[model samples]
Target: MAIGPTIGTGLFIGAGQALAVGGPASLLLSYIILSILTLAMTTSMAEVSTHLPSQHGTLVTNGYMYMSKSFAFASAYLRWYTLALFVPYEITSAMVNLGLWKPGSTIAIRLAIITTIVVGCNFLPERLFKSSERLFTAIKIGTMATLFVLSLALGLGGVDAQPPWGFKYWKHPGAMNEYLVRGVWGQVLAFLQCLFDGSIAFAFAPELIVHHAEMPASLMPASVGEAAILSASIPGIVKSDVAQTAFPYILSSLAMGVMAPFNDTRLTNNGTGSGSSPYLIGLRDAKLQIVPTIAMVAILLSAVASGRSFLYLSSRTLCAMSELGHAPSAFSTRNRGNVPYLAVVASALFSSLAFVSVKIPSTIMNTYLLRLVTSACFISSLVSCATYIRFNRRLRAKGMAKRYSSSLQPFATYFGMVISTLLLLGSGLWVAPNGNLTGSRAIRLIVSYVNIGVFSLLFLVHLFKDFVSVAEVDKQMDLGGRSYGNRAGPREPRTQKMHPHRGGVYAIPEASGASDLRVRQTMFTEP
Candidate 1:
């Protein structure tokens, strides 16, 4: 459930570019920081979600409880919009990938089929949805594992009589590739780029984990699921020829028309086609036609699965927002199957924005939306960190820090916030390479920071309606006693409700009437 959509095209395709630009050492370090951030964010969120459980709210709901409503609304709005748009983005990519095989299929017909499949999957009963997601995600992971084994076999002198190349690439490329500037600053810029790419790969894991935090019957705790998913990303990169093939090899392959550079013209190419991917290039060089064909088919399924997950994510986020009065009430409507049909439809409609790219060129469309999406991801991370900071302070305020303590409390939250802020601000570097904001550069700047502007406007609206001062926000830190929309607050322990799939009966322990906190503690707390 957690890893399904999290490691999408970014980890599958964009990782090659990261490995090419930042090298193996830089890639490892960037992912290390991201992994730590993932841990800190997930652990803190687990505490907060359990502390202030809400059926419809995600991390965004926790944000509202701990911080200002405006901040929560901004985060939710941006996140919801991003996820909605991403659905079409994924489906469109799937359609285009299909184009590689079905050259005669019209984009319109393919888009309709893709959209129908995505929405229809969500309309399944809750139990079926969960099972289906698990199966597809298992397939995706299995496919990736197969790729890893193949990469190792080839690197270890399998097929084509290639000499065994063990860690030679790292030594030659020298582990860190400079970018933009020179010396220390260039390394800093490269590291930041790696972090940004990593964040894109790790975009919505935190939001989804917040949902699992309250599900006692889940196979694994959300925090554990997050750690597993984040750990998988490292291997996804390192195992690829993107990291294994070495920089000199990549350059030489390009020279021989066997591969393209990281900044190849194919970079502008979108969709699931591996035209720009170094992984496919490496396979082609190895002359493994059968495996590449199988991988392509698997990647198509992977894209559709990601689209399905994003549909779930977007609708749920909208439902959460609607619960908080941030979206229309119609969005909160649900069917007998426990699916939010209205929210699903609304999100799908918004996802049609991907068709706009079909009309206008792919390069411009990707360039424009990618910046906005990347910036939103950074802002969302920063907001999550801030919300975690406030959540910890609230726990301490109520003297429940020991009761619901986070492993990296206080310091981790602060550190994550600082790093998130820097990434959000410096992400605009991709916008204006020469620092001259004109033409596309100017558009990129606006697109990158447009979320900030929208957030500001939303914050101003919040001020006009329910103005909250800094001191007031501080005073309202403790959510254990407050009320929101008829739901019980954190102080009043509510019974854990079973999902519709559970036949509306809560799963009991060996002894009934046992405390829910004990179950959560057993599931989440470090042994």
Candidate 2:
């Protein structure tokens, strides 16, 4: 369920977009490249969490621990604010299909449908909501399996036609491709769009994956790993032969024609895995309605479950940031229900901005691009990860107790950082004019530089406040121990107590009595 929404409706649609742009070879190449990048980055993310997973899953909470409030705030905006306010894109994408029922339906009808789904589904209580999630995830898989069976049959029967120029033809189309006619600048924007599209899945992972195979218990972690393993292990996603044509692969079979990859209400999947809903995109058309129907239902179920989980996740992000003195305190305050009642209402209000998406003119393709959300989230996560690595190294150097990693750790951490920095820079500024850092487009071009700005602005403000001496911070950090002055008595010397509770076990409540500031900080600040 967590993974589903993060994965979004995009993967199902990416093929057509890719086909229009670069054809089979290019699309497959991009998928492989992005997949490797994501894997490395995620593994690095997992590695840090293995040592220490923050209570606040959004980038802000973890970010504030190492970075500053401004950095954390901007990151929160980049991830949560953008994400929370992203109703227009997501809901629009979710509802784009409804028009197929009544061709040329009025925007009112479409908005109503989207509104109904987004708002109505959220009204359900938590338990029933989660149960439906399990049920829906099952159905989606069953349908996907059926699609694969059909794709295999079609493949065996030779119903789908392969491109005439051979598999690699699409990869080297020059500038003549319809999708790239916008010149290098246009091409750059297009790439950014798709890259951003790819990020949708990554951001949603924390929400979706059950146990990170690393995250500690007592954190009330989420489990959307079902979808992830399913995405990874599904035969359709595997490609022993990358040179094969696109039709036979997952996208064409499941999400392409049936789901119609480019029907854009939001700038979703863009018809490519980085392009479409990868799960649906992977499956093929099954003549047996049960299979595809079940899949569609499952996709919908994921959307529904994600809505609740996201609400909880988003509100709590607001709450956690508030605890860190980044977000407004009221927004962070919780009700007796343990709900960030104000934050939830605020999130709902913020999400209403998605209504503007209704006016964007619904279509099978979207003009609005949302790649920034992906870039910002990944940037924040990766930077926090880089900080985590530093924290761990410092802890180890100081003779602190910690787990040992083999060769994989050093390589993955550094590799992820370099690659993350490159991807962020390249994806944002590799193109020109619009990205040329001059004239009216400079702001937009600079917005493309969100990652640098995210880090810089936060660092500068933290420097101004003197939160941590710039020089000392430049030195290795000690994340396991926080620095508190006389207000909390002389800071306790750094110590390790076996992490107190087991990792990867059931949740345990941390002590939160007001008298014990350390425990309160542990329950709150430690995120």
Candidate 3:
């Protein structure tokens, strides 16, 4: 269930685009690299989160607690809009799955209906929402399992009397495809493009797992011994979760490589629903009936389920920001059902953007949104690694015991930081260098790198505000000290003690001090 959003339309529908650009070899390689990166990132995060869980998700609270307020502000808002944008991204994908790829009145109506279902689910009572989520998660897992079995059956010639065509497409069309140009340079470009496109399937996955761990329903350790036991099991949990999520993808990629060649125009076609799917293509080619339709229905449900889960995540993220004083308090308000109704409403507003597909094809719109979401994901991953480094240092300084510690440690975090930076910087390089800056290419370039600009703007704005606040605090302290000295002849120096808690750091005055020193410390401290 924690992996619900990770396995979605991105794998089922968006992989078509990746397969189109990179061919089989690139698709397999890209996902493998991304999976390793994600595993490292998640293990590091789990180590930190298990030590001191937060009511608000670790993605929102960890930056402020372990790093700086300004970084927290920028990353939180960046994550907010990124998750918000995902609502429309999934909805658009669902529309495409429903044979409504081109923008029109029918597509618009379907969009509205699906959007309503996705957003409406979030407003349900907490128990009901959880039940629905579990149900959908089951469906997603089942669909994946079924597809994998089908892929194996089809590949081994176990379906509909068709001859075994093991790796036939891979051998003929070759392992990799050339993109924009021909030969080695083009293959390199195709691999890079696959890395970018394939990222969507695993975007924000670490954050999702951390959030799931912090949920009330999750089992929490009841004592120090229990905590130690939980900590010892974390690495196993991380590895198992990663394998469960990644193996299906790798198998599916291999299956697709055998099922349909990269050059098949149907894979890139605009409006054929499951017809564009390699699995369906293979099944239909084998003269298998009824199964493709069933698979199409499953894909459609998976998309809608993914959209609903993303809407839930986006709304909760907004609510967390409000709780942390980064957004309006009204956004944190909840109804009797314990739903953050205001935040849900605010986040749901972005789903209207799905209608933009009415003017543009859903395929193009999905690509644009995928670029933006993946860019945000890269930045967030980079920040998480940086935060973990600070957290690790603070724990060492305080000589504190960790509830969970990964063996891959500092190396993993460092690797994550380096890879994330490279990915973010190279995101737009897929646009190609033809000496002609076409309008479509220009738009793609902007969409690819726009999140970096937005993140910088947010960070600077918060940094300036923090600077002003500190200056004012210093000014007030100066005047107050002078006034007190004149009135009392001399003032006693206060002895302040630092106390670290699970929530954050606080400065407490010693009992012998003249006055209480109640300061809010945002930097990392031992818990």
Candidate 4:
């Protein structure tokens, strides 16, 4: 699930754009920096999940337990909504990929067909979903390994092209490419551009650690460490691909950084589609006929797998909302197969929004969707950090802080919060070509941050329905639960009892005509 959609066009197709604007050295450095920040987020999430594992473990639940009810409501809605859009975005990208094989195809039909299939698959039993996810993840990993080896071979002068590519372009381009205003300011802007542009690739990934937070502390160290390391490696490997093979493959068609010029007509400006991918470009240049086809098919399958996973996650998020009483109880309903089919279908409906892409230019829609996703993800990351800080405080209050690992604690949480908050604030600037806030600029800011307004509205709506004081929220929180003792510091051979119907720390009255908002606090316990 983490590896599938994550390795989609963002790294494969979008890396070229990052390479084009930031050059090799700048892109490489920026990615390394972002990777650390991403690790900070993953580590923080691991701590919370370790400390407070729930059947529907989410920042939303953590928010309610450690913060205000309003905060919880906003977090829950934001996550469900943000995650819902990903289904359509991946589907749309897949349609664009299909365009590569058959130009001017009817996108609407293809999108609907694909979305239906993804939604239908979610209705299957949980074990089947897990099995298929494992298969897709394995295939995706194999694809990446193949890419690394093939690109490495190409970099070693596998083709009888120019001189053996050994960072030759890096010397010519001198690593960094200048952007926006010139001089030192331009360099600063160029680096920031790379940072912002490259960020989308890693969005929502750190949250994956939460999925495994229920495991034993001893088991967590490896999974938590591996999640961060794997995510951080994404940009490094892709940047290396461009540095070694993509840029060097067709130097004449590309700009100074050994990548196609920023304005290259072939580049997928929308940040979707593999038609113009640097890896595909290298494959084409090397005259590998069958391999390029296989690579494209792999990309398509990755998109499908990612779409499927997003649906699975969306349903889970909805279940969390239902359990928290922020969403309709119907969404909490499970089929005989134990599938939250209502939430699955509700989430899949967001994919219908992809039809809007059919009318708008692919590049325009891509930019809008990319910025939207980036902003929401940054907001969600900050929420995670805040929740972790509050959770730690509760642990310390109960004298359990020492019982848990503080390896990267407060520092990473604080650092990630600050960085994510700053990025979320400035994310709108990327939408505007010039920094000036003109009419289009103003609109772009609103569009990019529409999620913030929506989240705030959600908080207000919750306030109207179930208002609670901050003091009460903290006082009622169940910090003393036995689940908190399941930290990494201690281990027991006793068979831990599994309690599926643990009560919540607090409950809110249902708003008028909001019967489905009835709350239940079901949690996951390790055995």
Task: Give the number of the best model, judged by TM-score.
Answer: 3
CA lDDT, every model vs. true structure:
0.58, 0.45, 0.76, 0.63
Candidates in descending lDDT order: 3, 4, 1, 2
Better of 2 and 4 by TM-score: 4
Comparing candidate 3 with candidate 4, which one achieves the higher TM-score?
Answer: 3
lDDT of 2 by residue, 222-302 (tens): 243332343233122212212221223334323232222233312133321122342343233223335545555555544
* Deviation (Å) of 103 in candidate 3: 9.3
Scored by lDDT, model 1 comes in at: 0.58
* Candidate 3: tens digits of C-alpha lDDT, residues 377-416: 9999998998898898888988987776788887888899
Backbone collision count in every prediction? 0, 38, 0, 2
Candidate 1 C-alpha lDDT tens digits along 1-527: 44554445555544544555565666666666665666666655555555444445455556656676566767778788788766765665565445544455366666677778887898897678878888887887676656665666666666666655555555664656677888988877876776665455556655555554444322223334442343233222222312222232222222212122334434325321122344455565578758766776776787788888888888888886775566889888888888888888888786676666456533344345455666777777778778777766766787763324555676777777887788789877666354322246667678778888877787677656553443344354445545354445454433332211101112233355332211221122111
For every candidate structure, what is the RMSD over all alpha carbons to the true structure, in angstroms? 10.3, 9.9, 6.0, 11.8
| Candidate 3 whole-model C-alpha lDDT, 0 to 1 | 0.76
* Candidate 4 colliding pairs: 55-524, 247-258
lDDT tens digits by residue: candidate 4, 1-527: 33343456566555565665666666666666666776677667666655444445556566777777678778878888887877776776677566765567577777778777778888899888889888887887677667656666666556555344545556775667777677778777777776666676676766654444332222222324543444334333323332332222123112213433343435544333123555566676667768888987886777777778888888889986786566899998998888988888888888777787678644455556667777899889888888887777777787774223447767988899888887788776566464222237677778778988888898898776543443344344345422333544443333333322333322233455221212245554331
Off by over 4 Å in 1: 95-109, 168-174, 217-275, 324-326, 361-364, 399-402, 434-439, 467-527
